[model samples]
Target chain A: MTVTCPDLSVEIAGLHLQNPVMSASGTFGYGVEYEPYLDLSQLGAIVTKAVTLEPREGNPQPRVRETPAGMLNAIGLQNPGAEVFIDDKLPALQRFGVPVIVNISGRSVEEFARLAEMLSIDGVDALEVNISCPNVQEEGMTFGVDCDMTGRLTEAVCAATDLPVIVKLSPNVTDITVIARAAEQAGADALSLINTLLGMSIDVERRLPHLGNVTGGLSGPAVRPVAVRMIYEVARAVDLPLIGMGGVMNAGDALELILAGATGVAVGTANFVEPAAMHQVIDGIAAYCRRHDVARIADLVGAVAADQA
Target chain B: MPRATAILRHREEVVSGHYLLTLDCPEVAKAAQPGQFVHLRIGDGTDPLLRRPFSILLAQPETGEVQILVRTVGRGTGIIATHDEGVAYDLLGPLGNGWEAPAGGEDVVLVAGGIGVAPLIFFADGLRLMERQPYVRSIFGAANQEALVCWTEFAARCDEFTAVTEDGSAGETGLVTDVLAPELERDRPQHVYACGPDGMLAAVARICRDAGVPCYVSMEQWMGCGVGACLGCAVPASAGGYVRVCADGPVFDATEIDWERMKRR
Candidate 1:
C-alpha cells in the first residue's frame, strides 16, 4: 500500500527514522520526561543531553534567565556521563520505539573519542558530536569557530565510533558552512546545525551577567532566522543530510528546514514553550502535504530550487 | 496521557499589566490541583522558541475554563497576552505538586509578594470554602500601590490582611516580611502558605525557619519542558542537589528549600 501522505520518513546516519522530527539534545531528556505530557513514539528520535566522559554537576546558580524573545542557559553540560547514559538512559530510551541519537561533548579531543567509543556499544542509533556547547572552560567554542579543528575532531569521533556520526555545528562561528564542509570532509555521516548562537543578557540593575556563566547560548524564536540562513548555506556547501533546528515552533517552520535542504529537524526551544509542540508540528506537516497536493513528505526535501519563485 | 486539545477560549487583559487567559482544556482543568501550572505556547512560529510557564489561577471544570494570570514581562508573556480569543493555544498542564491546604480548623498564614500572589490566591479560597474557621492572614508586598493587583479580593477573604508597599504608598512601609514579623511573634500561626518573587520567598522561608513553623512556598522558573523531563526548571533543595519546580513543586515546603543557594540565583 502506497503511503497516503508523502513519505516524511528520513534516514540519517544509518538510523531509519519514520519522520524527521527528532527532539533536540538537552531539550528532551533521555526520552522519559515527555511521557507524561506527550507520546514519544511519534517522534523521529530522542537525542539525549550532551554526554561527557564523566558525570558533571553542571554550572553554579543562576544557570538560566529569560531574554528578549529567547533565553540564555549555562547548564555546563551536567549529565550522568557516557557510561551512565549507556547503562541507564539508553535502556529507557529503547522503550520509546524510536531511534536514539546520543549527543556527546568533551573537554578534549581524546574525551570526544572516548565518549564515542563508549556510545558505540549497542542501543544508540547515531552519535551527534556536540562541538556546539558554549559552557565549558575549554574546547567549547574552540573547535566550532575553527574549521580545521572541527574537521580534526569530527574525524576523531568518526574513527572512535562504529555507529554513524553526525557532528553538531555551532552558530557562533563566522562562517558556519566552513565548519559544516570540514565535518563532511572528516567523514561525518550527517550534520546537525546550528546549535544555539552565542549570547548574553545583563541584569541592568545588578550590573552583572544575567546567566550564572557570564555568557550563554541563545535559543528560541529570536535565533530562527540566523539558524535557517546558516542551515541553507551549509546545505549547499555539504552533501551530507542536515538536521536543522533553531526556534522552530510549528510544522511550517519544520517544512522550511526541509526546503532549505535539511533532511530532518529537531524540536528544541519549542519544547520549553509548549511540551506537545513537536507532535503538533508533525500533524501540521501531514495537513500541509494534503493542502499542497504533495504525495510524499520526502518529495518536499530540497524541492525549493534556486530558480523557484 | 490525555491527548486533550487546549484551545484559547478567552483572553482577558486583567489589569493593564497582566492578562487573565482562559484555556478551554477540560482534561487539564479536571486534573488540575490547587498549586499546579501549565506551560503555554508562544508565537505562531518557533522564532521565539520555548514555552512560557504560568501558574493556575483558577480552573472551573463545570465551565471547562482554566485561567492563568500572566504578567507580560518578556517576549513569551507578551505573546501570550496578545493571543486572540478563539485561536488554539497549545498547553501542557495541571503539572507539578500543589500546596497542601490545612485539613480542618487550622489557623493559616498567607503571604504574597508582587505577582507571587497569583498562585496562592486559589489556595486561600479553597481554605475559606472548607469552613475551618481559619485565622487567615495575608501579608502582601509590592514596589508601590499600583503594582498590587488582587489586594481587594485577598482582603475580603482573609481574616486579617496586610499590604506592604516599598515606597509606603499602600500599607506597611518596609516589606511584607516586616509586616509578617510581628504576626509570627504574636499570633504564632500553625501553618503558612506563601508565593511571590524569589527574594520575598527567601525572606519568608527564613521567617518560617526561625518560627519553627511549616510553610509551603510556590516557586517560579524559566523551564524548557514543564514536565519532569528537561530538568531545566530545577531549584536547589535542602535535601541536596536540585528539584524540578515543574514536577516536584511550584509549591515546596519552606524548610525543604535551599534558600542560601536560591538567594544567590
Candidate 2:
C-alpha cells in the first residue's frame, strides 16, 4: 500500500501545494492560455508572467531563439498591466482552484510596494517579485544584483501586503546566495532561484543578434546544474523556504533541485516543449517516491547527502 | 488542441533542401485549418530546445494525415528533413487561429515566396471544398526556379497561378509584387493573402495598402510554445504595442501590423 500510494503534498512558505511542480513566471502566461493542453486544477500552482504598473509593449521581434539544449527569450516583460491582470486574467484562473502566484516587476522600490498593495486581493495567493527590471532611481542598476536594494525592495513588498513574498533571484549576479540571504533577512517569506541566465546568440551570416533585444535569458536543460548549485547554496545560507526553478523539465530534474534544497520546483522552458509537462513531473515525483519508499515528497527536500559513499 | 505523438506516414523531397513530411494524427488533421501550424519536437534531446513550427500544407481528415514542408535551414529542420518514415513525432497541433478566408465569392490573390507557399496551398485546398469558391489567382516567387518548391500543385487548386524567379529561370524574372502590381491594376482584387520573408510581406502589404484591398499575411517568428502561453512570437501591431504571432495570429490583417516599425530578426 505504501508503494502504491506515496503522498506528493508539499508546504512552502505556509501554502499547501498538491505537489512540488509550479509554472515558472514568464513561461506560463497567467495559467489560462494552457487550458487546451493541460488540466489547470492538477497543477501545484500558477505563476504569471511579469506584471507592471502600466501596460508594456515588450521587446520587438524576434523575441526567442532555440539554442543548444535550451532556448533564449527577451520578451521584455510584456503584460496588460496590474489592473488588466487582476480584472481580466485573474478571474479566469480563480476557477482553476490552483494557487495564483503573480510575478511582478517595477523600476523602483516604491513601484514594487505599490504593486504589492494593489494585488493583495482575495484570489491572489502569493507574490513572486521579479527583481530583474532595471531600477530607474539607481541609475539603471538591476535591483537583484545590488544586495542593499534587494533587501530594501523585499522589505517594502513584504510590508505592503499580507501575502507571502517570494523574491526571485537572478543568476546573472556574481554571488546569488548573497542576494538570497539579503531577501531572507529582509522579511521575505520565500526565495525562488535562479532566474534565466543572461545569454545571447548571434547570426554569424548576417552579423546580427538572434533576438531583437540582443541578449536574452537562457532557460531549459542547459541551466539545471547552475540552478541546483544556486539552490544548494541559498538553502544553506537562508532560513526561508526556496522555490527552485531554471531548466526544470521532468521529475528527475525537479528532484535534483528538491534534494538540493528547493521545497517547490517551478518548470519554466519545458512548458514550451510540452504543455502538460508539470503533470508529468507531478506524476513522476509520485512514482519516484513510491519506488524509493519515501512516503511523502517533503521528506526529499534538501535530501542530498554530504558524502556519496 | 491535442498533444499527439504523430507517426510519419511518408517523407518526400520536394526539392533540394526542402522536404515534405506527412504525419498521421487524426485529431490534428480532422481539425486542421489553413494557415495554422504544428509544433514538432525535433528529437529525443534538448540541444535544439524549442519545438519547430511548420505551417500545415495539407490535411486529409479521411486519412488522418497532415503534411508540412520542411526546409533544412537550421538544425531543427535538418533533423526532420532526414527523419525516416514510421518515426513518431512529439507533436502539438492545430495550434493558433487559422486564416480567416473570404466569406464567399471575391477576387482573391495569394502571394507566396518560397516555402511560404505551404500555408497558402492549404488555404487553396480548403477554398475548393467551400460552398462558394472565390476567384483565386496566386503568384509564387523564389530566389530562382530551382529553389522554388511548389507552384504547379498550387496552380491546379486555384483559378489561376503565376510563377516568378529572380533570374528568369522559370516564369516572370521579377518579384511577386511585379506581377501583383499589374494584376492589381488589371482587376483590383478584392483581397490579397501573402506569406514569405518579412521583406517580401512588407512589400506586398504596401501594394495592398495602396490599392485599398484587404490583405492577410501569415507571419513567421521564432516561437517558444506554439500555444499563446509563452508570448514569445511577438510582432509589432499598428494599434500600439505588440501582438503574438503564435496566438493573436500566424495570420493577421496586413493593416493590423505596423510593418515600418517592425524589426524582425
Candidate 3:
C-alpha cells in the first residue's frame, strides 16, 4: 500500500487554492515585500491591501499603537490608487506563481463597482471587497454596518466583475450574521469575516489619543476569540465559503478558525511579529493532518463536534 | 534577511530610563547598514504581541554582535529593560533603508536628541571606516546631562562634538538646534543626517533647507511590519501623499517630508 500526502488544497467558490493559509490584506503588501523572507508560492493566495479610486495619503502620523496582546491601526487605506496598483504592483505580484486577490474599498456603491471593473485584468485572480476599513472617516465601515447597504454594494461589485468576489465583513455591527447572510444573498462568491473591531487607546501622559485617528481597528491574539465566535455564527448562517481572520498568530489559531467553520484562514497581525508566519501555519496544518491521520485538510473544516460546541 | 535568535551578550542601564542591549547575532550584524533597524520580540509570550522596532545602534559584523539603545517609554520597552544577560531575543532585520553617505571628504553633520542618538552612532562609525574622513560634527541634546548618551562614542568618530542640555548641565544650555543654526551660517556642511524627536528633526530640516544644505532624517513611527507591507509607518511626503517609513525610508531627504504635518503627531 502506498502512503499518499495529505491534500491541503481548498476551493473557495471558484478560486482553487493550493492550501488554506494566505496572508491577510494590509498585512501582506502586494506579495512582493515578503519575497525576501518567505516563498509567496508556498501559501494559498496573496491578498493585496485595499486599493482606492485615487492616491490617498491616509491618516496623519501615529497611525498605529500596540496594546496588550494586540495592536490598533488607523492606516486610512493609503494606496497609489487603482491604476498605479495595476501598472506597478500587479505585474510583480503575478510573477509569484500564486493567485493574487486584490482588495478594494470605496466610499460608495458606484466606486466599488468602478474598482471591481477596473481590477478585472488577467493577472488578478479574485477581488476581496473591503467594506470594513475602520480607519477611514467616511464610507469605509458605513456600507458594512447596514445589511441593505452591504447587499447592495456586494451586488454592485459582483455585477461589475467576472472574477470571484469575496466580501470582507466588519465585526463592528450589532449582529455579524445578518450582514454575512446579506453578502451571500447579494451574489458574493465567498465571505471574509471579522475585519478588526474598532478600538482606541489614550496616552495619559500626553492627554491625547494613541492613534492619529481617534479609533483604529484592533487586531492580534486579543481579537482571536471574537473572530472565532463571529466565524462560527456566520458559518452556520450562510452557505457561502468563509475566509476567517482576526489575530491568527500560528497554526493552532488557524485551526481554531477552520474548526469553527472557516474554509480558509488568513494570517494578519502574526506577519508583523514573524514575517514567515504564514508558511509556519501551512506546515503546522500539514503536521496536524498527519498526526490525526486526516486524509485531507478540507475534512477539518466545520468539523467541530456538538459536544465540543 | 534571515531571522535569528540572538543571545543577549550585554545589558546595561546607560541612563535613568535608557538601556543598551548588545546581542550576539552574526546573521543580522553582517547584513546591517547604518540606519537600518531590528524588530525585537520582547518575550516568549504573546501579551505584548507585536515586535518593537529599535534602530541598530552598533553593528560589529566581525565580532557577530549588534547593539540596540532602548529608552524605557512603555510596557514593551520596560519589559525589555528588565531582561538580564544570556536572554535570547527573536530578531528580524536589518530591515528598511539606511543612510547613504555623501562622497568622501565632504563636510558631514549629525544631529541627535535623547534616544535618537542610537542610529547616528552607527552612521558615525561607518564614516570612520572610510579611507577619507569627512569633517564630522555632531550635536546631541537631552533634557539634562544625565539623559545624554553616547557622547564619548560620538566624540571619537566626530571631529567636533557638541552636547546640549535643557538645564545647562552639559556642553551648552539650550537646544541642539541653537548650535545648528549658527554652525550652518558659519560654514554649511555638505550633508546633515539627523535622528531625534520629531521637533528636533523638523528644526534641522528647516535649517538645512534655508542653508541650501541637503538633509537626511531618520523618522520614527509606530511600526507594524518593519517591511513595507503594513503601511503603519506612513509619513506625509512634502510633494504629496504618504510614504512608508519602513520601506521608502527610516532615513529620508529632509525636503521629502512635510515637516509641519510630521510635528503634529
Candidate 4:
C-alpha cells in the first residue's frame, strides 16, 4: 500500500523543526554522543545536557537509581563549561540537519546572560534556559520556584541575545502557571514544561539515600500524568508556545502532551533505555497522523476534549 | 553499535547463583571484544526501568553468538538469570574499550574474583591462540569453591593456576593478593589483568603497584546509558576529575584509578 507521508513539521520560537519530537535536556548528552545508535536528522530539535559558566565536577558516585517504571538522577549539571562547549562540542552538532537547542544553567542572572550571548553564534537555533540551578545571589533560591526571579532571569536572557529564548519550568513548584506567565510577560519567546519532578529514594538495608546527592529529579513513564496536567494548565494560561516533556517513551505519550496544548514533545529518560526511542516516536507520530487523517501535526495542539459529557 | 533484538539461544545455571546466557546476535558477536560490555534490557517492558551492563564473556563471530556471565547479586541479575530461551531481548553491544594484548615473548598473569572471571576467560582464550605467546598464570578467588566462576576455563587455558577462597573451599584459604604478592617475587610476570569486587581490585592494584607490574582492571557500576551519554557510571580518576566507566575504560590501567576513593564506596 502506497500511503503518502503526513507532515510532522513544527515551529518553536521562530525556529522551524522537521517534526514535533525532540530530545529533552539532561537525558541527551550533547547530541553527538548518541550518533551510533540514532540518526540526528530525524529529530525536531536536539536539546543538549545543561552547561554552566565553568566546568562542574557533578555529584559524587551513585548518581542514578532505577525506580518503578522510572529513574532518578543527580548529575549536578556536569559539563565542560561554555567556552569549551562552543569550541569542542558545538562544532560537531553543526553538521546535523536538526535545530540545536543549547540548555544552560547559571549561578546568577549575569552568568545566564553571558552564556546566552556566548552561544549566539551560528548553528545554535535557540536556547533552553535551565533555571533549576540555585541563584547564589538570593542565598540559593531556585529561579523557577519564584515568579519574580523567573521573570527577571527571562528578561535578562531575552535581552542578551537575538536567538529565541525558551524558558524550561520545574515541576516542583506549587503552581507552575504562575511561573509560566512570568516568563511570558518577561518576553520569553516560548516555554517548555516540565523539567524532572523532585524526588528521592533510599535503601533500607544501608540506611542511606540511593543517590550520593541525597535527592534527584525523577523522569520516565511515571511522570506522564503530571506533564499532561501541567501542559494543559499552562497552555490555557499563556499564549506562548509550549514544548511538553515528561516520561515520554512512545508516540502515544507524545500525542497526549500535544493534545493537551503542546506545540512540541521532547523525549527524556527513554533515550537511556533505548537510544532509538525518539525515531520510533517520530515514525509513530507520522503514522498516527495518517491513521487519523490529520495533515499538519501542529493542528493537534490543545485538542483535548473539555466536555465532561 | 546496533541495538538489536537478539534471541536467547541458551541459558544455564553454572553453579548456585551464577548463570551463563548465550544470545544469537551476529552483529554484536562479530564486533565484540573482550573487556567490552553490553547494555541489555531485561524484557520488552518498562517495569525493570534501566538496561543492565554485562561483561562480554565470550563472542564467537563464526557461530553468530555471544556469552555473558551473571551472578544473581540483586533483583536485576535475578530477573536476567531466569530469562526464557528463544525470546528476543533488546541488546546494545561491543561497547567500551577492551584489554590490550601483550606482544610476543612476554609472561602475563590474570586474576578473577567471583564472576569477574568472565572477561579474563575470553582474554586467556585469545592469548592461547597466539603462537608466539609464552607462560601464562592465573588466580581465581571467591567466598567459596562453588562461587568460583569459570575456574575450569582458567585451569585449562593457563600454564599455571591457583584458587583461593575466604572459606577455604578450593585450593588455598587466603586472599588472592596473598598468592599474588609472592608470585610477583617468584615469577615477576610482565603484564597483569585483574577484575573483581572493589576491595579486591584495590588490593590487587596495590600489590601490582609495589611489585612494579603493570596491571589493568575491569570496573562495574550501575549505569543509565552505557553509550557514554548519561554520565551516570562515573569513577574517580587519580588525575583529578571523574571518568566514565562505560566510555573511558571498563578496562583501565590500575594506576589511572583512585583506589583510595573507590574503597570508600
Candidate 5:
C-alpha cells in the first residue's frame, strides 16, 4: 500500500513555498552557514540576517546571555552591508533553490528604502523590513515605536521595491495590533511577528550587566506565549498574511502559530539548539497532517475554534 | 559538519567545579580538530533550551570517543553535569576554526589559566601525533592547587610543564605570566599558544608582542549559533572592526585582539 503525501505548499503574497516552515531572520545566517548540517532546499524559505545600507560591526563582546528558558541578545544588526552581501553571500544562498527572503534594518525610512531598492535583485524573493531591532540605539526606535512611523516606514519600503514586503513587528510596545494594522494599511504584502521582547539580566556578584549592551532582545521558549498572543491578535485585526515566530523548537510549536493565524511559521532560537530543527519541523508538520487525515497543510492555518477564541 | 547522537562513555569531576565528559561519537571524533568545539543539547525539552558550547578537549578517532571539559557555571552546564554514562547527547560539531598546528621542530609554548586549558590540551595532543616533536613548555595557573586541572595529563606529554597558583599551593606562587615572561625573554619560543580568562590572555598577548614572538590565543564568548549565523560572539579586532569568534577564529593571532575593549566586556 502506498501512502499519500499531504500538500504542504504555502503562498505568502505572491511568493510560493514548498512548505510553510522558514528560518527566522538573524537565527539562520545567510542560509549558507547551516548547509553542513541540513539540506537548505528543504526549508520553505530562508530569511537572511538583518542587512543594512552600511556595514555594521554590531555590539561589543558578551552580546548573548542565556536566561531561564530563553536567551537575550543585542547583536545590533551586524551585517556586511547590501553591496558585499549581494556580491559575497547572495550567490551561496541562490544555490539552495529555496526562496530567499532578505531581512533589512535601516537607520531611517530612506535607508530602509535604499536597502529595499539595493536588495531588489534577480535572486531575492522577498524583503523583510526589520523595524523592531531593539539592540540598535537610534534607528529601530524611530521607525518601530510609533504607529505613524511604522506605517510610513512600511509605505516607503513597499514603494521602493516590487518584491513582496514583509514588516517584522516588535513586541516591546503598548499594543502590537496598532503597529500590525498600520503596516497592513501601508500596503505590506505580509507581516512577521513578534520580534524579540526587550529584556535585560544582571550579574549580582560582579554588580555588572550580563550583556555588554546592558540589555538585549529576549528569544526562545520563554517568549512563545507572547508570540502566540500577538500573532492571534494581529491575525484577527489585520487582513494581510502573517508569518509567526518565537521560541519555535519543533513541529508542534510551528503548528501552534499556524492555528493562531500565521500563514507560515519560522524557527528562531531553535536553530541554535538543533541546527536541523527547521527540517524536523517541516517533517513533523507533514507527519501531523498525515495523522490528522488533512489533505492540505494550509487548512491548519487559523483553524482554532472561533468559540474558543 | 555531521550532527550525531553521542553516547556518554565516561564522566568525572576533573576539578572542583569542572567535569570531564567523554562521548563515544565516531563521527564527531573523526571530524574533530584541535580548538574546534561541540555544541551540546543539555536538557530534553525547551526549559534549558539552547545548546551549550564546549571545547573539544580530546578527540580520539580510533576509539570513536571525544572528550569535553565542562565547568558548572550556570543552568545549562549544571543540568549537563548531572548526566550519567549511557545517556545520549545531541551534538553539533566539530564547529569553529581549530588551532593551526605549528611547524615541526619549532619551539612552542602553551599557556593556560583555569578552564582555559580545555582547548590548549587538544592542541598539545595534536602536536604529539605529528611526525616531529617541537621544544614544548606548558604553563598552567589557577587560584590555588585544587583549581588547577589537567596538569597531570599535560605534564605527561610536554617536555617541560610548570603549574602555578596565586596562593603558592603547588608548583609556583605567582601568575602564569610570571613564568611566561622570563621564558619569552630567554629562549623566545617561535610560537606561543594560550587560552584562559580575558585578563590572562591579554597579558599573554602583550608579552608575546613585546618579545616579537607570534602568538595564537583561543577566545570564549557567550555564543548563540556556534556557527557564524548569529553574530552574537563579536570580539573587537585590534586592526579595525569586529570579528565573530565562532566563525573567524576562536583561535586568533594574539596581536589581532583589542585587549582594552575586550576587558570591558
Candidate 6:
C-alpha cells in the first residue's frame, strides 16, 4: 500500500518539470496565490499571470460570467507589469521546487522583447508568450492571427532571452497551423496552443452585457473541442514540443492533448471550478498509466492516427 | 489535521440537481469539522477544467468516507455528477474554517435555505455528541416543499423545526426569516449559525446584529481557484478589507461581513 511518486516528469524547452501538471496562466496568478491551499512543490511548474511591459488594472468589474458549457472572462491581462513581476514575483517563485514560466503580453514587438529581456532573470525557467489577449487594442489579437506578425514577435522574443520561449496561440483563428508554423520557423523552442476563444454574454433583463467589458474570451469545458482540434492542427504543422490546453480537467483530457501532439498540458478554467484539479489530473495520469501497463506517459504523445496525410 | 491520502471512491446522483460524492479519506473525516469543504476535481475525461468546491455534508470516521453534496451550477459540477463510480478523483481539503459552537449554557440556532442545510446537519451532530443538550432550533426556507431536502434528518435533531416556503407550497407562508423572528424571541439563543442564498444570509446577519446575537454565516462566491489562487471569490468585510471565501472563510462572523457590499443589485 506504499505509493511512490510517478515519474511524470517532462522537459519542455530545456526546462525540467517534476511532472506535466501545470496551472494555466490566467487561472494561476504568479504562483504565489495558491500556496496556502496546496503545496506548490507538487506541481510541474507555475505559469505566472499574463504580464505586459507596463502595469495593467485589467477590464472593469463583472470580468467573468458563467456560460452554458464554459465561462467568459475579460481580465485584460491584469498584472503589475514586467518590471514589477521580476522585482517582486519571480524571486518568490524561485523558492518553490518547480520552474516558473512567465506569461507575457505586449502592445508591440519591442514591448514583448523588452518584457522578455526583463524576465531573463536567474529564477525564471521559461517564457509563455500570451498573444491571445483580445482587450488590448494594439498587440494581442492582432499579432497572434497573422503568421508574419507572429513570426516577427516570436523571433524578437526568442532573441531577447536564453530562457526557453513558448508561443501560446489564439484559438480565434481559422488556420491555427499557420501561426504555429510561423512560431517554429521564428525559433520558438516550444508551442502552447489554444488560448480562450473570443465570445461574449448579454443580460437580457438589463439590456446590457453580462460582463463589464462587453466581450471576453470563452474558456472552460465549452472550449475543449475547439482546443483539441486546434492542438491537433498545430501538431501536424509543427515539429516543436507543444503544450496543449483549454478545458483540460482530467487525465484523459490531458491525454487527448498529448495525442494531438502536445508534450504537456495546462489546466485553465478547471482551476476556478476546482482548485485541486491539477493534482487530480496528475494522479489520474499515473492511474491511467498503471491501468494500461504503460511504462511512460510520453509514449502516448502523437499516438493518434494521422488522417489527411 | 491529519492529511489522509483520500481518493475519489464514488460519485452518485442523489437529488434531482444534486450529487453525492464519497472520498475515501479516514484522517480527513476524523479531523474535519462541520462546515468545512473539500475542493474536488470533477471529471476523469477532462473537458471542463477546474475543481468545484462542495460542503463536507457528512464524514463517517469508521467508514473512512467523506461526503460532498454538490448542486450542479456549472460545467465542473456537471462533469463530476456524470462520473462513473469507483473512478479516482484528486481532493484537497477539510479546508476553510468551520463554525465553532458556543460555550456551555448557550443555545445554538441553525438557519438554512435549501441546500444550505448540508453543513448545518453536521453542526447539529457535533452539538448532540458533546452532551451540551444545546437548545437546538432550526428554521429552513426553500423554493417549495420538494426543494426542502433532508428536513426530517435535521428536525429530528432539533428541539423545534420551522419550515418556510416562498410560494406557500409547504410549511408556513412567507420567508424562513419570518419564521425565525418569532422563534428567536421564544428561544433567545445566544449564538446563531446560518448558510443559504446571499440574500438570506444577509438578512440573517442584519437580524442577528439588531438582536445583539452573534452569528456565523457561510458565504458562497464564484470561485476561480477554490484554494485562493485566482482571487475570484473575494467577499468584502466589515473591517474595510476583502477576505477570500475559499481561504479566509466560507464561514465568517455575520456582524464582521460588509452586508451592503455583498448585495448585488
lDDT of 6: 0.79
Candidate 3's C-alpha runs over 4 A off are A1-4, A307-309
lDDT of 1 by residue, B188-224 (tens): 8899899888888899889888998888899987676
Deviation (Å) of A164 in candidate 6: 4.0
Runs in model 1 lying further than 4 Å from the true structure: A1-5, A60-71, A203-209, A283-303, A307-309, B1-26, B42-50, B63-67, B72-89, B131-135, B263-265
Candidate 5: residue B230 lDDT (0-100): 90
Q: Compose the digit string of candidate 6's lDDT tens values, residues A143-184.
A: 899999999999999999999999999988888988899999
Candidates in order have lDDT scores of: 0.81, 0.88, 0.90, 0.88, 0.89, 0.79
Clashing pairs in 2: A69-B46, A69-B47
- Ranked by lDDT, the better of candidates 3 and 4 is 3
TM-score of 5: 0.97
Model 4 agreement with the true structure over B83-172: per-residue lDDT tens digits: 889978788887899998888668998999888999998888888888797578999998899988778977788899999999998889
Q: Per-residue alpha-carbon lDDT of model 2 for A1-309, expressed as tens digits?
A: 567888787887889988888999988898877888889899899899888998988877888888889888888888999999989988898998988899989888899999999999999999999986421223113898989999999999999999999999988888888888888899999999888888889999999999888888888999999999999999899898999998888999999999999999999999998888999999999989988999988898998995683
TM-score of chain A of each: 0.96, 0.96, 0.98, 0.96, 0.98, 0.95
lDDT of 3 by residue, A132-231 (tens): 9888877879999999999999999999999999999999999999999999999999999789999999999889998888899999999999999999
Error of 3 at B88 (Å): 1.7
- Pick the winner on lDDT between candidates 2 and 5: 5
TM-score of 2: 0.97
DockQ each:
0.37, 0.86, 0.82, 0.69, 0.79, 0.18
Q: Find the candidate with the highest DockQ and give its number.
A: 2
TM-score of each: 0.87, 0.97, 0.97, 0.96, 0.97, 0.71
Candidate 2 TM-score restricted to chain A: 0.96
lDDT of 4 by residue, A6-119 (tens): 888888889899898899988889988899988898789999988888897777778888989899887778788999999999999988878999998888899999999999
Identify the CAPRI category of the predicted complex in candidate 1: acceptable
lDDT of 5 by residue, A1-309 (tens): 223699999999899999999999999888878888899988899999989998988888789988978999998888889999999999888888989999999888999999999999999999999999999988885577789999999999999999999999999999999999999999999999999999999999899999988999999989999999899999899999999999998999999999999999999999998888999999999899888887888888989886774
Give lDDT tens digits, candidate 6, residues B56-83: 8788888889877778766677666777
RMSD values for the candidates in order, in angstroms, are: 3.6, 1.7, 1.5, 2.1, 1.6, 6.3
Chain A TM value for model 5: 0.98
Candidate 1 contains a number of clashing pairs equal to 18
